[model samples]
Target chain A: MREDASISINEIQEQIIREMARLDDWMEKYEYLIDLGRDLPPMETALRRDEYSIAGCQSQVWLMPRMRDGRMNYVADSDAKITRGIIALVLRVLNNQPPRDIAAAELYFLDRTGLRSNLSPSRANGLAAIVKQMKAAAAARMNT
Target chain B: MVFTGTTYKKINTAQVLDVDKVRKDFPILARRVNGRPLIYLDNAATCQKPRAVVKRIVDFYTRNNSNIHRGVHALSERASGEFEAARETVRQFLNARSTREIVFTQGTTDAINLVADSFGADFLSKGDEIIVSGMEHHSNVLPWQRICARRQAALKVLPCEHNGRLRVEDLDRLITENTKLIALVYVSNVLGVRNPVEEVIRRARARGVPVLLDGAQAVAHFEVDVRALDCDFFAFSGHKLYADTGIGVLYGKEQWLRILPPYRTGGGMVQSVGPERVRYAGLPLKFEAGTMHVAGALSLEEAIHYLRKLGFDSVRAHQRRLMDYAEGRLRALDGVTVYASPSRRYGAVSFTIDGVHPYDAGLILDKLGIAVRSGTHCAEPLMRKYGVGGMVRASFALYNTRDEVDALIEGIRRVQELCGECKSTRSLQ
Candidate 1:
């Protein structure tokens, strides 16, 4: 592991812990998750929508990002109501986090939110793929 | 123009889709969904109708809509002619022995249930076993499950091999003298993996066990000749193959259809009615009960012509190129993990990104005018097997292109930042 990257990795971990602790209920936490998705910078109109859609999602979303300081910085939006809420939750914890840390981000918050437990097996799957994609982007940043 | 991030080259999507011509064919594709252009990726559920199919339905209802066989009215004769002609077209489609062997039903699900209730209910017994594959859609899987349960028989599943293909070794292990049936999907709706149904059926036949191929996905993307494959039964939905939704085909061997009892007993199927027992007509009529979806069948013929014009081989090849482009570009991106290995499968890819949910991924893609499917894809068992609760599946038909793929790739990257990391995988081989 690169010595300098470790410091940033820990920073993300520390923030996630702090954020999780501060929130009292899943409802509050979900709001926080939405906030995370909201933090994702807006992608340019051209890159936001086209053909990059994953099938079986009930909503339309556009995602784009840039590499900054060797970490992934994302911009995303969604047309559907609930999906945008879900995206915000994902962005809150992972944005600006390094690849290794992002890859390693735990699902305890999801467990606490009861989102994982309640999602139809399919919805849970979509969650996993999105999380996997983010870590992959971070890993690519590290590799690059 | 297709949307793109600043980092990627912008794609002018207008050049990709012949907007006016193509959009005209599909009336629904032109409509807006959630205040955006309706980018349809729900073809696996059921495809939208082309003008040919829509027009056929309109003509049938407007001019000659009537019941088949018994009707003597002018409208009845015309409708009956059109309906029988539709059956002949289906025979050619499957290359069946004759139109008599082809039975119409509500859909693929109904077709399989009809076979299960008829052939399975009669020949299969308490000790018999039924074999299905890991890649079967729920429609193919459940009927066998219920039939086996009712008969006190065992239901065996062929395991999925690495890269999502069915293991023939497992098929062999599952086959035995008491094994009466093997039902499987020719191509998976989720993983887009192709199964070697011919080889599997050949082995099953060697053991004297019959096989049923669910051709719902296969009918659209590939050519099928049931005679050459020599499978005992083949079932598929017309909608998936470009026809109307209510119609589907259940093709059986002439001898099998003759022996198996009718699934539903009603008005048109019986030759002579008696208080004690009603005598049923032969073959196709025995299986077809009630007033059938005549106009839907007629529209299906038009759907077949649409496919003929595009040429299925060419369509599959075109889809492959797009799948290759999608597989390469998305899998190369950070945080993308593809579910299937690159092979000569149908045009579909299931994947996960590290930070974002599949639902979230879909919503973002939708906002960008790119539509996709997310969730278990109606294969909860398969989902459990994959160890992912669900996935994002991007499937394609004839009209998709390289630009759409590229746009998807770049869009995923942006979506990634919102989630934290994107971990899409490329096919290793």
Candidate 2:
């Protein structure tokens, strides 16, 4: 997926929508999300410090960011598997994208895929916060 | 169709309250959640209102809707009569000496704050000490903390054991001559462990320290005789007692109520207001200033009647059985840790599962139409003591059945599957 850094944000969202459409119901969608979470890379023990942690969510999520080849890279993990899976989805679309592109992308697919409404309020807030964190990181790199 | 699993016995619902029949009284119980029947396990947060309580609220608004204590019209007189009647009901319910001891406040927190502010201002001073237990909800702890900070009084904690049960022996050692008051929860909201109230009260009395029992959790499930316990103050919320929100009682000893300054002063609380000075009303009215929760008080009377009619012995027995059954089933689940293995818990149970965050488990349970509370349950100190981020709590009531516990077990197992192992072969590079 990193090889396709040139992929447009809209194209990535379309791919996500098509993938979500394959699921018939909420249970299936939840199961799929859990599986995605299960597949998330285990965060390093050293990186799981308070500095990297996001505070507002019901569950603890740790995100590590890096800049390489003029693209923003985010590696995230959650104590909750479903939440980790949601982070995985966010990473899939946003990672390896140029800072400017990542900062400006609307990511309307969250609403279009019904993930925003389907999730619990705290989780939904967490999702939005993660996006903001990503955008803030991008916006910071732009300022530099 | 009897549902039974290994080490889980089938409960005879007839032996207890007929949960199905009781369930019908609550209209909210019939509603569907995510295409499944609703299973309410968060009774400690707030129990669902029964038809009797709801009808009383509607009836109050329909017929006797008017300001209490001051109006000259028929509606006012009737409303005032009914409101005082509700106070009498609360007095009887707690076995208080008189209705004069019962003061209406917004809720348990409000009631506790009333005592803290009024009592602390008068009795406390620099270097005075107040003793609280570790298992108290933020509501119980904060008011005392505020008072202590204001008066320069030291706040002491009677710490709980690793199992979340406070040791009464610790109280004796913690209480010194500087100890002016002892405030504690009658039952912990998070762990469902009933505190050693008798032992706590005895120690406090020996020291001549006034005690306040936060009965917000215990009132619905346990029989609390304020006269028997002889606590200086008892506070509880009506919402947790199956009545409407915004109504609660502060049962203070008559002597204490008389001595403490008026917490808040306004229209109803004053007897005669002169430009130079104002005289406060007696007993309860001094605390219950302004227009009250007229409808809420009436509905609370209905809730009290409903409980008394059902009887406490049966209710306690039913809930004890439910708690036992719930703990046993939860313990049987693999990789599950059930907290507060106290010998006598009435209705609440807290647990955590390995490899699953409590929030994740709670979310999954919600999707399955089971409502369990997750997070610290407003007892962050208790959580810190246990060394856990949070827990999944399922508390019971008279309406909760064995079937709900079974559903909870099944839901947990499903959560374990959803959260446990990853089938995907992808690896972090």
Candidate 3:
């Protein structure tokens, strides 16, 4: 986790965009994402239940949220490696932020990196779905 | 291009097809995707239209654009003549008894729903049973399920074997006095196995029960003779047979068609309407309610013409050769498992890589410009039968070649290499 909680979501998003732009081709970009996904800490088996599972995904995905010191954090995992890599990218930009910031953050990095187009729109569950769930979770916390 | 005797001789041999020549007829096959030549292996989902079918659609709208069956003008007569002629074409294609027996539907799903709704309304009651094979697509399963639920009837399943072939022996025992209908897929979309529909129809006939074969996948790869098979009803989609979507056929025996009420009732499907009661139209017209897909029906006629030009024997031989080669190559792979090793198969070959999720493999393959279907394939029960979340399918059509199958093999290897490390840690459960 980064020590600087003061960093804005836009700054983190720009950093991600810069990192992705460095890759020359789709293969290199995917390799980078695979490495990032592999480095993510594995979610506990106890939390990986059907209750946390998201529907409409081609593969199984589990997402859970936690509030740490009034900051919103998500723990997610997917059976598919590519989907996990995508979830990893999403978590990097939105994790460890306050509920309002997490809820209001614009995820432009996915579109800028051309990853959004790669995910088929017919599949209702993908990057867009994960972001919706995260934002909804953040919104739920705001009422408390 | 018009198919003449010379075209047949130039493109087809005794039991083989000149696939290179055949590929030229479908212009989309030439386009590139993701900087690579597109390898289309999703024929079971739908097929690419030939030049003849495309041109027929354009020709219909440009020259013969008029409402069919109701117009008194010259354009209307021409359009109506062409539309009914298309019906005759479908009648000949299926070897149906009469043109009146063929009903135009939206697709296979709509065709199945028509039979389920109309038949269920007329014949079914509390405790009546409908038998369907376990390997049927959702289109075949859900209609019966919903009707059974609505009418307080029972939906009985004839389960498939572990290898995905339906057990025909169990059919005799499953049918009883309560059984009103037997619906089965002529060819499974996912497993690619041809169910023993002939034997099934014969058995169902012995019990005085009618059989409806979902021929959405069968019509593309082989000839279908509804009369010879003695199936009470046969349904298929036009797009699967190299034509446009939203147009399909439902072939019902005239005896049954006379007794059953119309599935959908509206304009052009009525003889008269009065203040007290409305009298519906006769035979096929009673079933078609709204303005039909006139262009689609005509394109279907053209598609049938295209297939007849290629010859069904050649189409069957070409598909069998490709499937045999694909299954052999797939089985030789170290970490791949091919599903449903039936003696007779067509249109599709389903398999899964040992460690990688099918969606992951599908995505990586798409990046390489290879299009394959990678989900449950709308046959969730069949997926459950095989104890798999999903399987990757490489479906073939007459235009496909051995070289394309080779490319698919290579694409699978690349997917394995890219996602190999994640295999150990990935677990769906």
Task: Note the DockQ of each predicted structure.
Answer: 0.07, 0.43, 0.42
| lDDT of candidate 1 at residue B158, scale 0 to 100 | 89
Worst 10-residue lDDT window for candidate 1 chain B reads: B1-10
After TM-score superposition, what is the CA distance of residue B385 in candidate 2 from its true location, in Å?
1.7
The reply for model 2, stretches above 4 Å from the true place, is A1-5, A49-51, A64-70, A118-125, B1-16, B422-429
Model 2, C-alpha of A117: deviation from truth (Å): 4.0
Lowest lDDT block of 10, candidate 3 chain A = A118-127
State which candidate, 1 or 2, has the greater lDDT.
2
Q: Write the per-residue lDDT of candidate 1 for residues A1-144, one digit (tens) a residue.
A: 655634454454455666566766443444445554454455566775555443333445555555778667766666433455566666755667666666666655555444554334443334445556666667667766
Model 1 agreement with the true structure over B141-254: per-residue lDDT tens digits: 788888888999898888886588678877677788888888888889998887888889888888888888888888877789999999989999998877888899999998
Tens-digit per-residue lDDT, B1-429, candidate 3 = 122321233344554577888999999999998778999999999999999999999999999899988999999999999999999999998899899899999999999999999999989999999999999999999999999999999999999997877888898899999999999999999989898898898888888989999999999878889889999999999999999999999999999888888898789999899997999988899999989999999999999998888887877777877788788998899999999889867999999998888988888888788999998999999888888989999999988877788899999998887777753342222
Model 3: per-residue lDDT, tens digit, A38-143? 7788788899887787765477778898888878889998877777888898888788888888888888888899888755563634555667889999989976
Candidate 2 lDDT over residue span A63-135, tens digit each: 8777888889887887776777788888989898888888899888888888776344654235556777888
Each candidate's TM vs. the true structure?
Answer: 0.73, 0.92, 0.94
Candidate 2: the clashing residue pairs are: none
Interface RMSD of each: 11.9, 4.0, 6.0
lDDT (tens digit, per residue) of candidate 2 on B1-429: 133432223354333354566778899999999888999999999999999999999998999899999999999999999999999999999999999999999999999999999999999999999999999999999999999999999999999897767888977789999999999999999888998898889988998999999999999887899999999999999999999999999999999999999998788998899999999898889998888998999889999998777766666776877788898999898999988778888668899999788888887898899999988888989888888988999999888888889999999988887776656442222
